[model samples]
Target chain A: MPTVKFTQALKRFFPGLQNMQAGGKTLAAILDEMEGHFPGIRRYLLDEQGRLRKHVNIFIDGALIKDKTHLTDPFNDNSEIYILQALSGG
Target chain B: MKTTLLLGTRKGFIAYEYRHGAWQSANLSFEGQPVSIAYADPRNGTWWAALDHGHWGVKLHRSRDRGRNWQEVAAPAYPEGAEVKDGQPASTRYIWSMAHGGIQYPSRLWAGTDPGGLFVSEDEGNSFELVTSLWDHPSRKEFWMGGGRDLPGIHSIVVDPRNENHVHIGISCAGVFETTDAGKTWNVRNHGLRANFLPDPSTDVGHDPHILVAAPGNPDHLWQQNHCGIFRSVNGARQWEDVGQPGGPAWFGFAIAVADDNPLQAWVAPANSDETRTAINGALCICRTDDGGRSWQEQRHGLPQSNCFDIVYRHALTSSGHGVAFGTTTGNLFFSPDKGEHWQVVNNYLPMIHSVQFAD
Candidate 1:
């Protein structure tokens, strides 16, 4: 199981799921698991065309994942995944 | 001559007494939480502070007695779940930027915000009405949000001092926009800017122009600190060239100041963050350029270099007759008498000092 953590701002939208444990081997699988727990969370993550929303960022570790659309980054056992609302401030 | 310092803090705003040879903080509560931008209207003797806090939301606070007391002009309320006709919300995320129109129209105030929106207050900052004409423009539909959390939030709103009709705005990751027709249309004006990390032309070019400053005397002269490097525009961003690296530690700070007495004079303080690296042991020094950003010199006569734990936020740098002043995240304030050299910590132990402006 990998752990997904949400930032303080996103907590308003997804309540009680501050940090969730997801069963997945890859980034897409983890999101699929997230959708199962909190529906429409994935919609805010993606846009009308199904592309990742411009403001959502998914990081496997500290490095930014390049595959924003499909997120093919691999996940290890006990891997730490973070879903941030992307700080859009200057 | 006398100097008045307006300090915009996260909690609220404070006025400083610079008459007896030192700066003293005069606390007031025009803001509910943290404040980001404070503009002093010298024409009508009004001080304006822009607020950005959670739950309390965004609004404006005005001071007529030079910060002795304050009043809030309630921000327009958007319906609970009303989406903007263009598919966004009316208020967006928060009020991120505010600017006085120009010396000619001192009563005019312009504001920009997150997600992506623009508004103007015609009646002396009493209230603001969204400029739906610009938001509802056909091109706005294609206006892509900068594609990440560090994406498009309106951060820079610059009004041409020479021409009131010409306006320039910088969005978080969306680069720079200009309107020649007052508010009729806007064009993405990014020519010599670059985003070295992102290999795409669209994304890399406009990823966060943190500060875009136009020369107070010459509207055509401008300077900026974006995601990549420090840039200068001689013809109002029509042409630009790299000026300097945000020198000193690996830091990215927002807040740029230019001297009103000298058009070619400018200063920038580098911080530790997303942009680039400063020296490992570098103190937060104000980098100055007297030749219109063509060359640079570092000024650190009096500043913290050992336990240098301060980050200057946007809209913090301000200059006037007394000198150039800026506040830090560590609650320490610094002022320079001869531009950037020979600084002093005039005030210490205040709340997070977000902005500092010298006026009246």
Candidate 2:
């Protein structure tokens, strides 16, 4: 199971998720589990056409995983996942 | 207990003085408005500030005797409809950056604006003349206007001490630009830079470069913080190499600085990227690269961890003879005494600090 966390800024969009834990061995599984639990969380993470949004950030551990379109990075049973809203102001 | 820290807020300008050990603010707006770029010149006993009143264009103000009295200079006019009149002036175009250079030439003043341009004033801040090289650059048409545009339009323009004509400007969507003929002709010396986020990933990775610093001791060498990572150019941007590669932390900050005593010694702030935001190890930390940016080490001793909102603006990170000072977006000013080995908070709870400068 991967521990997925939502940043405080995302609380306004996804009003239901305080915290979530999903069972998965890959990055996509974690996001799928999140969308399954929260009704519209995936839409904010992904575009209408299913591309990663321009300002959303998904991190595995501390360093950024560069597969923007697909969350195919291999995950361990104890991996920590973080979905954060990026700083967008000029 | 007169606090000398000038606070340039989003709404207006305030002068903060440290009385006892706490910080307090005094609104310095002349017409009860906000100031964008402000610098107090002790040499002439005049405080110069650029005001943004939304499409009123950029109006310059001068205060004699340190913010006690003020007078507004005539705002620069556009060439009629050839230039869009931001009727309000407060929102559309803003005076982004200001620098006072020229050792022998009576304290020259330079100001930058949105829509990408530079203006120079010879007689202090009383008047200004637009520098046309960047305004008329070959690729000026393709320059992106808003969102990720805040200081990119001529954000960093530093004149080399050894040679004045050897000037440099940091452009948005483009890499470092240099002019040897005094801004007459230009060259986009972006070799070895990463342009990996555009439709053509190879060519679009170099947009929105933040800080471009030319070491005063060695004008030939320069350091920069780009949208992708940090870079150093040994031959005045003729060639650049990624200095943030050695350190695993991603380089995603708007501020960079080089040691005044040692040109090779540099500092860059690495924040979480738009694609991957991680606060665990990647939130608001300074990376010191002793051997240039070939490698880096994190500098976080007294800084915050959870809401570590330190998004530095252009010219916000500055070095003095004794220490370094940088203002954070969270309205806090931090100073590092031992060359960024440790940090300390000088003042907290300030408005969004757009820029900061030391007085002469």
Candidate 3:
């Protein structure tokens, strides 16, 4: 199991989410698992093309994810993933 | 009747209830989120809040028991690779405004989004589909961003009470558009208006209308608070007539409201133009017109007399019967229970007020 943490910005919309140890091997899998717990969260994190939204960012164990299109970043059993929205808007 | 004032602000949403001549305010919900519009559909007792998350994206929240609890709903999004008639992919930047359908179509809702797009939800506000006919219109390319960051948006949705199929939408720099057969088709209705920013100054489609409203009594009589001036259309939006410049010195403001009983009577808060979008001479006064738009008078009783620089957004001003309400950018909320003759400050400070609506 990998630990997933959502930032305060994302938590504003999904109040039930904070930090959870979800079962997943990749970042995409983790997002799917999170979506299962909280529906409609994936649409905000990813666009209609299944790509990470331009303003959304994902970091696996303090390393920024490189594959935004496929989100193929692997995770270990003790990995910590952080998801956040990048600096945007006035 | 219980008068409820829903204020959408930059930091969240606030609900102020007026009962028996007193006001009660509630703490913020969706705290720190930029709420563009907070609307209560009295037809179904459903309250919809449009949140503009700066970084994440736009979202919609619904509450069944007023603002006690809320649940997230599917926000409008353009389909992947969906392009406009000008070959540009439609995008959803933010939801600026939302309007409920006519009584005949209870479950239907219309949403105006930033980047100049319209969305229709057949299942109330649970889900929405983009109005591609308006999005893919050939004149969409002519629409440009007026004062906001994104492209001009359909910020105003006026649904005719008599006919559910007749709808009118107002875009920032794109002018006014109306459709008789619902969202199946739309036509630009910006005739006899001026766009001072353009080379021609009177282009049909490039005019920026800050707000478009139709009185409940006369749905065919439409009033607009435009970027350049004010206008009125008595013939169902086919043509507009300039009725602003002759009545006031400053014709630049976003908010406009019409009396429920009279279509000829309206209220507008005029701000100084020339890059200073503030109350003229620091005197915040609301202009009222009783004879359609032929003449106007300043109504400043109990309002800020001096040192006021707040600007009202398009949806911030609304009316319910004889009562009129408006919220300013500086978080000042004013209400006039008897039309626009006098005013009372409901709340002085909260966050920058984005919208003010009477949730009866």
DockQ for each numbered candidate: 0.03, 0.01, 0.47
The lDDT, on a scale of 0 to 1, for candidate 3 is 0.84
Q: Which structure among the candidates has the greatest DockQ?
A: 3
- Per-residue CA lDDT of model 1 for B214-311, tens digit only, reads 87777787878766677778888886677765453212457677777666888877766553333225577777788877677777688877656676
- Tens-digit lDDT track of model 2 for B1-360: 113556566556666554565444543664334567767754564677777543123467788867887776644332322231223111125677766655545557777666566677777767666676666665655543333564235577778777666778776656677787666787777777776566654462245567788876687889888777888888988888787753356377777888877788877766667464333253567778778766688877887776554667656776655466677666678777677777888777666677665444
Worst 10 residues of 3 chain B by lDDT: B141-150
Of 1 and 2, the candidate ranking higher by DockQ: 1
* CAPRI quality level assigned to candidate 2 from its DockQ score: incorrect
| Candidate 3 global TM-score | 0.91
- Best candidate, TM-score-wise? 3
- List all candidate RMSDs to the true structure: 11.0, 17.2, 2.7
Q: List the residue pairs that clash in candidate 3.
A: none
Provide chain B TM-scores across all predictions: 0.87, 0.83, 0.95
- What does candidate 3's lDDT look like per residue over B261-290, in tens digits? 888999998988848888888888888889
Report how closely model 3 matches the true complex, as a DockQ value: 0.47
